[model samples]
Target: MAGETDPLATEQPPLSAGDLPAELPGELIAPEVAALEVPPELVAQSLGEYVRAWGARIRGGDPGVLPVILGLAIIAVLFQIVSPGNVFLSAGNLVNLFQQSAVFMVLGMAEIFVLLLGEIDLSTGYVAGLAGVIGVQLVQPVTTNFPWWVAIMAALLACAVIGAAQGTLVARLRLPSFVVTLGGNLIFNGVMLWALLFGPFSGYPTLGDQTNPHVLYQLMWGTIDPLIGWIILTALVVVVGGSFWLRDSRRRRSGLVAPPVSLTALKIVLIAVVGAAVVAICNINRAHFGTIEGVPWVILIVIGLLGLWTVLLQRTRFGRYIYAIGGNPEASRRAGINLVRVRTLAFVLCSMTAGLAGLLYVANQGGASNNFPGGQYVLYAVAAAVIGGTSLFGGRGRVLHGVLGGLVIGGINNGLYLLGLDVKVQFVVTGFVLLAAVTIDALSRRGASVGSVAHI
Candidate 1:
């Protein structure tokens, strides 16, 4: 009995980057290798070699952003052709599309925390609702009158505590994340309803009419001045583009593997072009009465958060450990990584991020009502992250993936509305799109595993 071996363990195939290695789907290998060391063959010393390397990755079944780009283009074009008056491509609609997408993007990012560690968060939707109501109630004129910033911080803090509770159950008690978070989802939803309905409030927790949190309302609806838009774009190009250039160039100079100079320049150029395009679009004056224009503040907020989280996940030691744990928990434990602390912290961050999304939802919807669709929102959050290419199995994702996926989800929704499809139809189409993405993910993994065994 003491020497008993697990039959399941013997049949476990092999460890993978985040899942069973079975030779790893090409896309999955990137995270595992990136956390350790870049493969020599994968490193390119010149522009041509870089191009070849990228091609090789695709051939190996890692399509990278290629699928996202192509799928987005197809959606846009199809919608443009089918929508009445071609309004789907109209500048006004496009800007609104971005506004519509803001919440999904943020929620997707929140899910990324535990998702990267091969965990799931079914409770994020109501968690967001609870956080939003707290922020709103804190700023109520009749009672607290807390400053907008203070209210926001309080909301995020609550999210962290919620995350801690759920994470503890999973990380310390070794409970299944799905069950823990599912329970959390129901519990938080009930708490949110209690706060909204039973709690002492002058009215429904509203960011709409409250004079105290006017700035909070403005966050989702307000636009930057046109001149400020250009200035912001310039700053973004210089700051973001410059950082990418400097980091990679420095790596190359130090004899570490990095992209070619030309490639780095290309990336900067693309950034400048895209930023300029967005600003140009936003500046196109879409108002029916008073000349309205400039980028929505939420756009910049998303970009800022993207940069922040990207740095947190890509450049920090904690980020590396998260990836390591996601890829191989036993190995991470063997390597002395504190699985409990890291896992719990990841859940905390996820909730905090989800809280921000909830706050934004308050801004967008004008209030955090008791009827908030936490269930639907959670599904979309998962749909967006997975559609954007974050593996459901984990250890292979980024904040950018969430952003990209948000756009796709946003685009599909925007297009359907333009086509005059019913809300139910929108849901159906979205489900299909999500299904397709998951199917592709599963197939890619299967293909990789078979190939791996053949080689062995």
Candidate 2:
């Protein structure tokens, strides 16, 4: 009775609404106390936390396919601006672009091996020229009378030997690559001059005694078939799409942040569009008197090389080691990687690729001449590689970069020619572009180190 007495006594006085607190009546005090205890400082801190989290999410590497697509768009705009009336966008011109960029692509792939190892090979162009000269000479009656295939093999082997020797000097002797390669450059050029002095090395076996024929020259020109182009485009789409899908799935399964589905789809669409455009442009007949079809064999060769080099760099253990060495040689050596073998192979491959390029050049030109200067061409090749995105300092480039860079240079040349600019001006502009590319690469790398989004 005593314990229950307060229940009625407490309820005797009814409180007015004005006398009650704003909070719900008869609510537990603990909850109110907890709510009131939250600090003003904490509220401010929570807002700051939320803002920082949001900033991070937006700036993270998941910007969809915007960057790549945007880059391509910009390239298109630039080309259009440089060449009025969109002449650069013509189908025949597009095929020409591929042909023009092909040599650069091959050289770029070759350069990738040495680049990955953080070494330089200056003799690529000379070696290539020499290989071509020697190859042609071997097949000529005045020389060895060898089969065409045999001549090609001989040229490649010679290049390989030269490359290996240079590599040995750099790796085994512990010489600086720049010095070794620079010397090789001089030596190879001298050899090329010596080969060219005695007789004409005609590249074409079937042409017979003619220096240059208009009909044969026309045959050398490339053409594009719309149907074939479309077929190739379809194949490319399937391959590229499959690769992306597989890659994304693997990344997701491995707990990595994969590209958004939207981004992937967008990339596919853009690639398809570009591919189709290229095919369509190439299908157009540029010559009013005659017709040209599909991309030149040269373009095919370059694309093939690009694909091969990409695989080598991205998939092979040797490629991995090359990059590791470039990134940090000491770490690679400590990890039991064979620096000598890798470096040697790199030089050999570089030279061999150069040789192939030389063959293409001779084929394009119809004959080899004593006045041919391999030194100048070598410089162009180096410039092309650097311009395309292969870092002169190494460890940060791709084969495709070389192709693009080559095209950029080629574009400048073509554009200037269309505008009736002088050769000297072309050279100056190309040099400037090369310098700019290197500067950009250095700056981008620095920015990357500093954690900036604008580094690229």
lDDT by residue for model 1 over 41-130, one digit each (tens)? Answer: 337667787777666555555665677778899998999999999888788999999999998999999999999899999999999999
lDDT of each: 0.84, 0.67
- Error in Å for residue 106 of model 2: 2.4
Runs in model 2 with CA error above 4 Å? 1-86, 141-145, 197-226, 250-264, 452-456
Q: TM-score of model 1 relative to the true fold? A: 0.90
**Per-residue accuracy of model 2 over 1-456 as CA lDDT, tens digit each:** 555542111222344567556775333334322222222222222445433433442343222222323433555567767776777667666666666555565666677678767788888878888987776666665546666677778889999999999999998898998899889888888888787665543333322343332222222353446577788779988898879878867976897656555556666888889777766666676666876666555655676677788788777777777777888876566556777778888898899988887776666666566655577677778777777767777676777776766777677776676567898988998888778777766765664444432221
What lDDT score is found at residue 102 in candidate 1? Answer: 91
Best candidate according to TM-score: 1
- The top-ranked prediction according to lDDT is 1
